[model samples]
Target: MDLSTPPPDLYGRPRADTFFRFLTAFGDRYSPALGGPLLRRNPRRPFSRPTEALQLVVTARRRVAADVVELTLADPSGGPLPGWQPGAHLRLTLPSGRERHYSLCGDPADPADQADPAGSAERSGYRIAVRRLPDGGGGSAEIHDTLHPGTRLTARRPRNGFAFCAEPAVLFLAGGIGITPLLPMVREARRNGLDWHLVHTGRSADTLPFAAELRALDPARVHLRTDDEHGGPPTGTELLAHAPRGAAVYCCGPAPMLTAVQRALDASPAASLHFERFGAAPVTDGEPFTVRLGADGPELPVPADRSALDVLREARPDLPYSCKQGFCGTCEVRLLAGAPDHRDRRLTPERRADGALLPCVSRAAAGETLVLDL
Candidate 1:
């Protein structure tokens, strides 16, 4: 660990000192926090034991696009599954015990869409789409190659990090499988009779998932752009050229696409952007620190370029974590000692004050030791 000087001034990672201040200013500008709709009237449908483990059976599976497979998970006894809204994701534990989080693409209102071909009206399932990532960790590959009908998997209830909010106009930009979370959001926006548009882009039409469904919803409002058809990839500015002024923009895609969209937002301040990345944000401006597990447990050193979760896992490999990005609360632990340089978007001010921190993307200041409830 380097103790030579202070940390780098990375614009990407939020600094602990200014995070709460930024949050208040951001809420004032955005009108509502990114958690969800501020004007929702209907109560969330009843759900039992949201955080408990559920054994779900795969009732149906099919290829929706070139590398994407849509899987329908249902209760074995045909009971109602937990209710969720747009932007919610499921924590799936694969047969090999590797955990992965996938956005809930299917409509929560119609949980068992076509799962019961026999025309049963039971709201017995949830749907998710997975794009096989050969270069990524093995979760996607396992789902693509090994999982099939009748396969049972362990999963946690839905959790929403990239929630859709109420607005007069909405603009959605999706890249490849990043469309999963936005799918339900688009549906909700349209159902509410709100003005909305979608710009779906991918390598080609063959690689874009749910193209037919999108067009079937509204042909004129959906713009499907492909790199092959458009000569090459488009600039972030080009993507927003046709967006409505003062629209709420929701985006999910490759990091380059997101970075481009963020850059475009800088030039076009009329639109407010809310985005969810496919993977963890790259750590930047991090300073090395120490973490002492529990009271007398080992003190582990977290390098400047790495996360505390990554280092702690070496000592406790079974340490639970779903999304390494810190959006999900799976890796959160009690902050027993030291001031944390909080970087996660999941924790609220109340939770932080209650002594909780997500180690996945957060750390301690230089020369300080963060004692966690391992």
Candidate 2:
């Protein structure tokens, strides 16, 4: 293995590879630099890296769909912004202290390269779209309701778990706002004159953002399917009809749609599927456990259907957590007792051995009781 070339991160972004991968995966407390610090089980602040986060201003905001809004973010100074490839997403820290990931929907090239005769302030910007969820954890709602032009926000570097694969034959499947990441992929495919087709499905035309813009690229290749027009949602088999025998399939959508597409892929074993989910992954084969906030604290029952983070937050509402999927390492707490299942993608074995566990996705063994330093 090439030590210089780190492996893909938890999100699978190839360009996001870094030496930290080695430190996190193999390093112990004795390891130097990133490892020693990372393995510290009881740091005052968990994975705090304020300097790496960019403070950006909202240069523009517009409602692109019924409940989706597109935002253009740029550095406060007129300077070149970081370049990202298709399928990248920004880990945005909202003013309300909530963090949410939004796909980079705009062109990958920095806007600074394009000359604007009118001296528009759109230089060096990254664009993202958010769909307001009435029942979500308040991140999306806060973004839709409060963010506007001139508003400032913090965003980590772009990470792409769903990197685009430039296959000879490509089929893109997008459901509703899931089109954000796939938009740039389609553009890249078109720009390269690759053989590709896109099937965008939604509840209706108004719910799909950039519908007209996508259609304008290639009306014949871009297929728009809506429940209102199509009578009902298409089956997995029906949707797979658009693909060639060995075409690569990229899909981002609601859980049901993703599941359907995945199930259909079993029939066409030659074709591969890549997907990205915006919500917490459902607990699978979970076993019940008991958790204590502190040594002498109250013990709470963790059911199979719910995450420990969800239950713990009800008691301690101020518990910090983001990306309940377990990649952010925000809900990491020192484990005082019990063996953790260790399901998160962020923490390394050494860290876990040092008594650290992410409450968001990590849990104890069946019928086991875990003591956390809440």
Candidate 3:
């Protein structure tokens, strides 16, 4: 069967009935009276343990751009840090107890390879850049104002939801600080000698982080377009014009730019596009609903102003959750029944069809009651 094509009985009433019949026949043929081992399945689903939080100290902090700051975090005990691939992000627990996620922008190669043999060569560190969001949430402000060298912080092991695709060629489009996750991907592409091009845009040259570093990487392949110098931002038509046929387009940027890129890629049949959003998923106009955790559990009221995860956590505080913005899949639960509004960006159309829901941001239809596996 073609991997891209869905099976005829992939999802529907027919599939469920067929599965039920198969299970019944199998049980009848392999009974305990036949002297064979009884077929018993585990009741609980296997789940991978969560990544442990690392105690890291800020070793260096520098302003890389007008509002962007680069922070270097190292293990306080001087040990090797966890390895991470391109497009990975670290969830940081701030001093105020607020959890925030930031992408790793530095090189993924072992730092020990280039360090002196006697000077903690085996120890590795992570470099992350953050842009101050004055009018937005307080996480960025906390990092900018209070975090400094010698300050200790806790962060989870790196996890990646956005990953690089293996393609013959790639086109990278970054807007402002969105370039953080794509930085390592560009380096890897260059190291592998892949055909790659980068288009970076910002309000002004001063606002674009890593401007000098990106220019030095490959001036021929890197295109910088600033609103001040170009009269306006580069249009999607101009960006795609440089993308060759069959190339994979990876974009991480402001919502407006991403929306425009999506529209442009929709018109292009030769190139495939992937996106990573730095902000929360677009909110929907939803009404209050009810969520039943288990068959015998009490129904919880989910208010329109609150999330299902928040409501459920009030009663059951052990529920797993991280990055409440819905980008991470930590809070995903099996949907036993109900029509989900499905607002999460992590779940694909096919996965949503498979009865999975991200409770952190997803909701049920108005007046609908959802039954969850929790």
Candidate 4:
């Protein structure tokens, strides 16, 4: 029984089925290098997927400015949160235990997207600004008014809904409450030594936070326009009228402001205009529809009268849901079959084409029985 190497038959056996699995993984990463083999092997994989959440307890909370509050979070095991890129957002599940996305405005020195949950203590801290809106009291007010230090809340790993580009020059447009996300981006841009400018539109300097920080950003570069005093909307005639041509324009604010910017940038490079909505997503011409949770199941009726999530809640009050606005992707479910009339703005085009749907507000076409993979 001298079987020093008796397993000669198993040598090539391991390579038979998985002869190219390693190559496949390699080709997947280096797509441009092996684009042919990669696409031919797996053609339908989605470009992006919803993010995952990690439960982080609040270790400390401090007010930095009149509106902005500094919050420190750590892993459930009392370790630091992950390092993230500038303009990245952490999904904060409020005390009411609902989730909302907030931009991190703290140190942008480290950019760790896939940070380890265990050893993230050194890069554990993050900063977010909360402006209490009179009409908005869902979560921001809770963090501002009710929540305190040592409170435990769940946090989704940081995600980049807006990221800076390597363009030679860039223009950042911010309306009243829209500066939160752009704040970090500007800091990071300056750190990277990029040529950038800001157009901040507000009722006045009193209503706008981070005024001094933005003002100190090179007088020749930063422009603060107050409608209450400036007498007009910051527009092509006001803001973009003197915009340096060929710079990427990133705008975020009220729909009206964003639409105006979009219309102006429309004639320019479509690739250069980037926008993100601070409020609910806009999906017009929506019609009533029905969704079947499974095959032969009772088709739940969805009304344009209300959101799909509202209807689902009216039907089953026990179902789990966090954000009804489609930001958290907490209520994510797979589509077993049938095409979905996706209305979410968070997901990319490639993802929607993969039959993904957010049950929150999205609907289905007539005669289309939407199936949920939950």
Model 2 earns a TM-score of 0.84
- Over the full model, what C-alpha lDDT does candidate 3 score relative to the true structure? 0.79
For model 4, residues 28-77, the per-residue Cα lDDT tens digits are 65565344443433444556575566777666776644565667666767
Go through the candidates in order and give each one's C-alpha lDDT: 0.82, 0.81, 0.79, 0.66
Clashes of 1: 0
Comparison by TM-score, 2 against 3, better one: 2
Rate residue 344 of model 4 by lDDT. Answer: 70
Worst 10 residues of 1 by lDDT: 5-14
Better of 1 and 4 by lDDT: 1
RMSD per prediction, one decimal? 11.6, 6.1, 9.2, 11.4
Q: Candidate 1: which stretches are off by over 4 Å?
A: 1-51, 110-122, 290-303, 311-320, 332-339, 345-357, 369-374
Q: Give the range of the ten consecutive residues with the poorest summed lDDT in model 2.
A: 1-10
| Quality of model 4 by C-alpha lDDT | 0.66
Pick by TM-score: which candidate is best?
2
Instruction: Return the clash pairs for model 1, or none.
Output: none
Q: How far off is residue 61 in model 2, in Å?
A: 0.5
